[model samples]
Target: MTLKQQLTDDMKTAMRGGDKHRLGVIRLVLAAIKQREVDERIELDDAQTLAVLEKMLKQRKDSVSQYEAADRQDLADVERAEMTVIEAYLPAKLDDAELDALIAAAIAETGASGPRDMGKVVAAVKEKAAGRADMAVVSGKIKTRLAG
Candidate 1:
């Protein structure tokens, strides 16, 4: 099934199982997906849906960090739980070695020799990595590779 369909199915399962937390998170995801579709006037494919999931995951991670910094363990735990739920929908992430290999290949493919070419290399890496790797990490790696 498509990712959207899977979400819907899981939502129904959550309801049947009386899983309040899971149901809430699933609804939040579906709502975000629907809002994006309405705003863009188009249905999102799997890749686009994954993008939304990644964005939500990033926001949750930020919230977790901020809550922890403020000594709000309860809030941080909630965010962490939400993040775990969100991560279940994402594709398998690339390991460090695999990610490095992809970065190296992107740099070579784009002929990126210095920091000035960072954008080109990043665009290439983002296209290849997409949901498989974090863009922030990829960009950092690209910067280091280009600068050194």
Candidate 2:
């Protein structure tokens, strides 16, 4: 089944199991997906769905940091929980070794020789790493590699 269908199934399972927290997170994901579809006037494929989940995960991460900075452990915990739920649906993350390999390949493929070519390298990496790696981390790696 598609990722969207999996989310719907998980939502039903959460409801049946009386998992309020999981259910709420699943609903939040579905709502975000729906909102994007409505705004774009098109259906989202698995890649687009993953993008939405990633965006939500990033927002939750930011919230967690802000809450922790304010000494609000309870709020931070909630955001962390939501982040965990969202992460469960994302593609497996690339580890340091795999990420490095991917970055090297992207740089080679794009013939990026210096920082000026960073954008080209990044665009290539983003296409290959989408849903499988964090773009921010990938970008940082690209910068470091290009600079040195």
Candidate 3:
């Protein structure tokens, strides 16, 4: 099933199971997806849906960090809980070794000779990694690789 369809199915399951928190998070995801479609006037493919989920994850991460920094452990815990629910829908994260291999492959594929070619290499890696790896970390690694 498509990601959107999966989300809908899970939403129904959550409702049946009386899991209100999970249901709320799933509704938030669906609403975000719908809002994007309405704003862009195009149906989101699985990749686009993943992008929306990634954005939500990023927001949650930021909230968690900010809450922690302000010593609001209670609020941070809520964001962390939401993150757990959100992350359940995402693909497994890439391990460092796998991520390194992907970076090497992307650099080879893009023929990225140096730091100047960072964008092309990063784009290639990002496409292959999809939402599995963090791009900022990948970009930094690529920069270090190309620099050396």
Candidate 4:
């Protein structure tokens, strides 16, 4: 099944199982996906859906950080749980060493020379690693490579 269909089925399962937390997160994801479809007037493919899931996960990560900074452990816990749910829909992430190697290859392939080449390098990396790696980390590696 497609990722979107799987999510819908999961939502139904969560409801049947009376999983309130999981259901809430699933609903949020479904709503986000639906909103994007409505706004764009096109159905999202798996990659597009994964992009949306990644964005939601990133938002939860930021919320988790803010909640922790405010000493709101309860809120942070909720965000964390939501992250766990969202992450299940994403592909496995590349480890730092693996990510670095991929970035290095992209930089070389694109002949990225310095900070001016950061955009080119990022575009290449995104083509190869978008759903499999975090862009923030990829950009950091690119910056360090360019600086040195």
Candidate 5:
């Protein structure tokens, strides 16, 4: 089944299980996906759906940090909960060694030689990550490799 269908099935399960927290998060995810489809006038494939989930995860991460910095642990906890639910659908995150290998491969594949080639390397790695990478971290690594 498609990712969207999986989300719908999980939503029903959560409802029947009386898991309000999970149900709310799932609804929010579905709403976000629907909004994107309405705005773009196209149905999202699995990759595109994954991209939306990643975007939501990033937003939740940012909110969690900001809430904590503002001394609002309660709010931060809510964001963290939402993040966990959203992350359930994403692929397993890459570890440091794997990420480094992927970056090296991207750089080599792109024939990236210097800082001027940063975009190509980043694009290659981003494609490999399927929009799942923390771009800030990836770009920093790419810059260091190229500039050094």
Candidate 6:
């Protein structure tokens, strides 16, 4: 089944199990997906769906950090819980070594050398590694590789 179908099925299961928190998160994801489809006038494939989930996960991470900085443990906990739910839908993330390997391959494939070629390298990396690796980490790796 497609990712979107799986999400819909999971939502139904959550409702049946009285899992309010999980259900709410699933609905939020579905709504976000729907909004994108409406706005773009295009159906989202699995890759696009994964991208949306990744975006939501990033937002939750940002919210968690902001909440913690403000000493709002309760709010932070909520964001953390939501993040956990969101993450469950994502594919397994790449570790640092694997991410680096992908980045090296991308740099080589693009013949990217020095800081001037950073954008080209990043675009290639994003095409290959989006949703699998953290872009911030990938960006840092690109900077280091270029600087060296």
Best by TM-score: 3
Candidate 5 TM-score, C-alpha based: 0.95
lDDT of 5 by residue, 94-124 (tens): 8778888999999899899999999999989
* Predicted candidate 4 versus true structure: per-residue lDDT over 1-148, tens digit per residue: 9999999999999999999999999999999999999999999999899999999998999999999999999999989998999999999999988888888898889998889999999999898886999898888889999989
**TM-scores of the candidates in the order shown:** 0.96, 0.96, 0.98, 0.92, 0.95, 0.95
Pairs in steric clash, model 4: none
Q: Which structure is stronger by lDDT: 2 or 3?
A: 3
Rank the candidate models, highest TM-score first: 3, 2, 1, 6, 5, 4
Q: 1 or 6, which is superior by lDDT?
A: 1
- In model 3, the runs with Cα more than 4 Å from the true position are none
lDDT values for all models: 0.94, 0.94, 0.95, 0.93, 0.92, 0.93
Q: Which lDDT tens digits does candidate 6 get at residues 54-125?
A: 999999999999999999999999999999998988888888888888889988999987999999999998
- For model 2, residues 1-148, the per-residue Cα lDDT tens digits are 9999999999999999999999999999999999999999999999899999999999998998899999999999999999999999998988999999999999899898999999999988888888999888898999999999
> Candidate 1 residues 70-112, lDDT tens each?
9999999999999989999998999999999999998899898
Residue pairs in clash, model 1: none
Which has the better TM-score: candidate 2, or candidate 4? 2
Runs off by more than 4 Å, candidate 1:
none
Off by over 4 Å in 5: none
